[model samples]
Target: MRFLLIEDNRELALATRDRLTLDGHVVDHAADLATAQDYARTMSYDLVLLDIMLPDGDGRDFLAYLRDIRSDTPVIAVTARSEVSDKVGILDLGADDYISKPFDFAELEARCRAVLRRRAGTSSNTQRIGDVAFNRLGGTLTIENRIIELRNRELRLFELLADNPNVIFSKPKLVDRLFSFDEDVSENAIEVYVGRLRKHLAASNVSISTIRGLGYRLDIG
Candidate 1:
């Protein structure tokens, strides 16, 4: 999944970005609210990790702005404030969940998954496409109860395709979701990943179909 991390603390932002990247997620970090607002306005993110205190302004204002713009993207507030009133206020301001500072990265990731699951309207993190079973939280793919070994990028690509079956994803859109802003990506990067994924799904009842001039889609029989 693609994530926008709105944080001012360089150390904490780096740590959070690294943690999420290990799970095959693409993360873009903004050091201040201005850059964050620019990112929010331009790109589409699966989730946003927002810090309450910012260098430019309060994160609550940004949350309100997002809601005012009618953006439905799920946001989880990451702040140092642990008071019940603070938590309630953040949620009331449009945060889907709240996590205090000095929190565990595992718990943060779990909360991210939970919020995403809720947004997707599914209680379970596992999604099935034909005989392929994908555990979104665990980042595992299984077919016939056997695990299929996939590299991080491969798994990320498959996750996007599986999550939106039959939906055509353009190459640019795939690149945006699969790679971060700082990554040096090649023009044929998406094609390479798609080719690799197709080979892995060859034995299953699922296929990745090229839409020629359009893009690609996951087709299930």
Candidate 2:
């Protein structure tokens, strides 16, 4: 998944970004609310990790702005405020979840998965499509009981397609979701990933069908 991490603490931001990247997620770091707002305005993110205290302004205001824009992007407030009232207020301001400072990275990842699951309206992390089973938490794809090892970007693409199932994803949208702002990607990057996933699913009942000018859709027989 792609994420926008709004944090001012350099060390903490680096640590969190590294951890999420290691889990095959693309993360864009914003040290202030201004950059974060710019990114939010231009790009689509699967999730947003926001800090309440930013160098430029309060993160809660940014959260409110997102809500004001009617953006349903899930946000997890990563703040140092540990008080109960603080958490309640953050939630009331439209944060999907809150995590206090000095949190374990493992727990943070788990919370992210949980929030995404809730957003997807699924109670379980595992989603099955034909003979394919995708474990969102573990980031594993199994086909006919055998694990299909995919590269980071390929796995992310597969996850997006699997999560939506039968929905057509445009190349630009796929590129946005699969690659971060820092990566220099080509126009054919989405095609490359889609071709790779197609090969992996060739023998199964699942397939990726290109709709010519429309884009690609995952079809199940």
Candidate 3:
């Protein structure tokens, strides 16, 4: 998953970015409102970690601006404010989740996974597609009670496909989503990853099937 971190504290932002990167998420950092808004307007991020107090203005104002533009991207308010009203107000203003400052990095990561899962329409943290049990929070995949370790790209590809089972994604679309910006990607890259994922799922009920001239389908049934 790709994330945007909007924070003013340089040390905290760098530390958070490093932690999220280590957790297998691509993170972009912004020091203030202007930079954050600039990045948000141009790039497609899966989630945003926002600080309520910015150097320039209130984070709520930024949230309102995002909503005004109709950006439904999930935003998690990570600030020093832990008041019930503050949480309620942000939730009412379309924030996905809230975490107070001086928080545990592990807890923040967990909250991030939870919010992203909700956005992905996953009801539970552990999802079962066919016989495969995927722990999104734990970042592991299990088949028939056995654990299967997937490479980073493979895991990301599988996550995207499994998130929308039965939906046939075209090659170009798959390539765009799976690879990050600035990557030197090839048209065959998506196909190659799909092939590897198919073999990984061969023993289980899950499989990625070719859709003739269309693309590929991560079909469980």
Q: What is the lDDT of candidate 1?
A: 0.89
Clash pairs, candidate 3, are none
Worst 10 residues of 2 by lDDT: 132-141
Candidate 1 residue lDDT tens string, 1-221: 89999999999899999999998899999988899999998899999999989988999999999999999899999989878999999998889998988899989988998998788677898887788887776667787778877889998888778767679999999988888888999759999989998888887899999999999999998
Clashes of 1: 0
- Order by lDDT, highest first: 2, 1, 3
RMSD, every candidate, angstroms: 1.4, 1.4, 2.7
Tens digit of lDDT per residue, candidate 2, span 36-123? 9999999989999999998898999999999999999999999898789999999999999989889999899999999988987888
lDDT of 3 by residue, 71-141 (tens): 98899998797788889999999899999989999899889888888888877978888888987666678
For all predicted structures, in order, the TM-scores are: 0.94, 0.94, 0.83
Give the candidates in order of TM-score, highest first: 1, 2, 3
- lDDT against the true structure, per candidate, is 0.89, 0.89, 0.83
By summed lDDT, which 10 consecutive residues of candidate 3 come out lowest? 174-183
Q: Return the clash pairs for model 1, or none.
A: none
**Candidate 2: segments with Cα more than 4 A from true spot:** none
